[model samples]
Target: MKKILLIALIGYGGWQFYQKQSVAQPVTEPTVQVLPDYTVPLQKAREAASLLQFRCDGRQHCSQMKSYDEAVFFLRNCPDTKMDGDNDGIPCERQFNKG
Candidate 1:
């Protein structure tokens, strides 16, 4: 009886080991998708800013204006451009130095 129990335990352990070894690992690869280089038109940026009551100081209104692409993201994603610059929950009016 003791020998039978020991053999059964060994067999179970071996089966568990084999099962773990046989399991396949998931393969991960970076996705490749063609995306057009997007930029916000100057007119569109000005229009959005104007709609939000944003005042351009000197040459530009918001220092957050790094590029047209960034501006486009802001215009599209930011609900409150006048109040949110970073788009990280903090309002733009509160984040910008002038604001």
Candidate 2:
């Protein structure tokens, strides 16, 4: 009877240990990067721009952006910036310093 009780106690302890381990393990959800609020406008612009055909005007390219914000808008909204050589979100490394 003691041997049976010992076996049952061991099984109960093992199950409790498993339950604790399972609960201790973190359940990870996929992480997503949230952009700045300024980018929100650019996202809306992209939707409008998508309707139009894109061509490298050379006159209206990403390099011509006078400011970083303008470059970001173009890079994000305009599909034909031709500035992001690395295909990164940034545009005009020589001009903007950042992508």
Which structure among the candidates has the greatest TM-score?
A: 2
lDDT of 2 by residue, 16-82 (tens): 9999888866789999999776645886787556545342344346547676666655666665566
Best by lDDT: 2
Which portions of model 2 miss their true places by more than 4 Å? 1-60
Tell me the TM-score of each prediction against the true structure.
0.29, 0.36
State the lDDT of candidate 1 residue by residue for 3-84, as single tens digits: 9999999999999999999999999999999999999999998877655754333232245675444444455555545534
Measured on C-alpha atoms, candidate 1 has an lDDT of 0.60
- Given candidate 1, what's the lDDT at residue 3? 100
Query: Lowest-lDDT window of 10 residues in candidate 1?
Result: 53-62
